[model samples]
Each structure stands twice: as C-alpha cells, then as structure tokens.
Target: MGDTANNTENAPKKSFFKGVKSEFNKIIWPDKQTLAKQSAAVVAISVALGVVIAIVDIGVVYGIEQILKIG
Candidate 1:
C-alpha cells in the first residue's frame, strides 16, 4: 500500500537524524581559553606567511626587472 511505502521512506530519515544527534552528543568541544589560544596561533601564522610571500614576490619582480634591463 501507499501508506506502507511512505512509512518505509521516512524510516531511513528518522534513523539518520537519530544517528546524527547521537554523534553530536559525543563530540568534546574545546573550552573558551583553548579556543582563544588556537585562534591567535592561526592568525599569527597567517600573518607571518603573508609577510614571507610578499618578500619573495618583491625579490622575484626585482630580479625580472634587472634581467629586462640587461636584455
């Protein structure tokens, strides 16, 4: 019957949501102090990498300009 088919279709969805909720409950979230330290580390590393890339770019451009002057 159509009612049985509809029940079977919705059964998978209900079980999937239950599994998702169970998994969410098992997660151990980081505390605020740990979160702040991790965030600061990420920002500091990003800034340092940006500076390095800029320095390398400037060097490459300068080298190319010097080569053009020679040619």
Candidate 2:
C-alpha cells in the first residue's frame, strides 16, 4: 500500500520528462533554403505592416490637424 502511494506520487514527474524527451527527438529542423525563404517572408510582412501603420498614422494626424484648424 505504501509503495503504491509512492509510485503514484512520482509517476507524473517521471512521465513528464520522458514525454518531453520523446517530443524533442521528433523535431525536424528546416534546411538553409527553407530558413532563408521563411526569414524573407517574415521581414517582408513586417515591412508591409509598418508601412500600413505609418500611412494610417499620417492620415489620423492630418485629420486631427484639419479639425483643429477649422475650430
């Protein structure tokens, strides 16, 4: 009865690390060509988003300035 309790107590910690090790071994890293392609995609998307935000910012600022001028 005591051994059963002890086993149940330690079961989770042992299984957790074993599962982690199993998952880590399954990883297949990208090759150089794939890495470069993905990197470029990320950079391109980031720059596109920045440009969009800048345009929106400029529009907002211009609108506020025109409103203030009219008042």
Q: What is the C-alpha RMSD, rounded to one decimal, of candidate 1?
A: 3.8
lDDT of model number 2: 0.96
> What lDDT tens digits, residue by residue, belong to model 2 across residues 17-66?
99999999999999999999999999999999999999999999999999
Each candidate structure's TM-score, on Cα atoms with residue i matched to residue i, is 0.84, 0.78
> What lDDT does model 1 reach?
0.96
> Each model's C-alpha lDDT?
0.96, 0.96
Clashing pairs in 2: none
lDDT for position 23 in model 1: 100
Specify the poorest-scoring 10-residue window by lDDT in model 1: 6-15
**RMSD (Å) of each candidate, 1 decimal:** 3.8, 3.4
* Tens digit of per-residue lDDT, candidate 1, span 17-58: 999999999999999999999999999999999999999999
Off by over 4 Å in 2: 1-8
Model 2 RMSD in Å is 3.4
